[model samples]
Target: MIVIFQYLSIILLIFLPMPHYLRESYLASSMLYSLVCSNSMKSLIQYYYDQ
Candidate 1:
């Protein structure tokens, strides 16, 4: 899912015009944040299981 969003944002950033609708910009930002959050959550889960 993260990979998908990364690809999507890349495509959107490339092909789409600037000054897009507010929601579109927000989606891009949220995708970036979700990627970071997901990584942290994955590590935390791994640590929990390691215990």
Candidate 2:
């Protein structure tokens, strides 16, 4: 699911038109979002396994 979202976002980034600074910011935010999502998912999986 996360992979799919990343792919879609990348495609959007390529196709959408915006200022260069805005594009950079969007890329940064998406990277951060994915990092947070991955960390939370890892913790959730570990929690279930530890139960």
Clashes of each: 0, 0
Candidate 1, TM-score vs. the true structure?
0.48
For all predicted structures, in order, the TM-scores are 0.48, 0.85
Candidate 1 positional error at 24, Å: 4.0
Clashing pairs in 1: none
Candidate 2: residue 32 Cα off by (Å): 0.4
Tens digits of per-residue lDDT for model 1, 1-51: 867877797787767766668657767787779888889999999999999
Q: Which stretches of candidate 2 lie over 4 Å from their true place?
A: none
Using lDDT as the measure, the top candidate is 2
Give, for candidate 1, the lowest lDDT window spanning 10 residues. Answer: 17-26
Top-TM-score structure, candidate number: 2
Off by over 4 Å in 1: 1-22
Tens digit per residue, CA lDDT, model 2, 1-51: 879989998999999998999999999999999999989999999999999
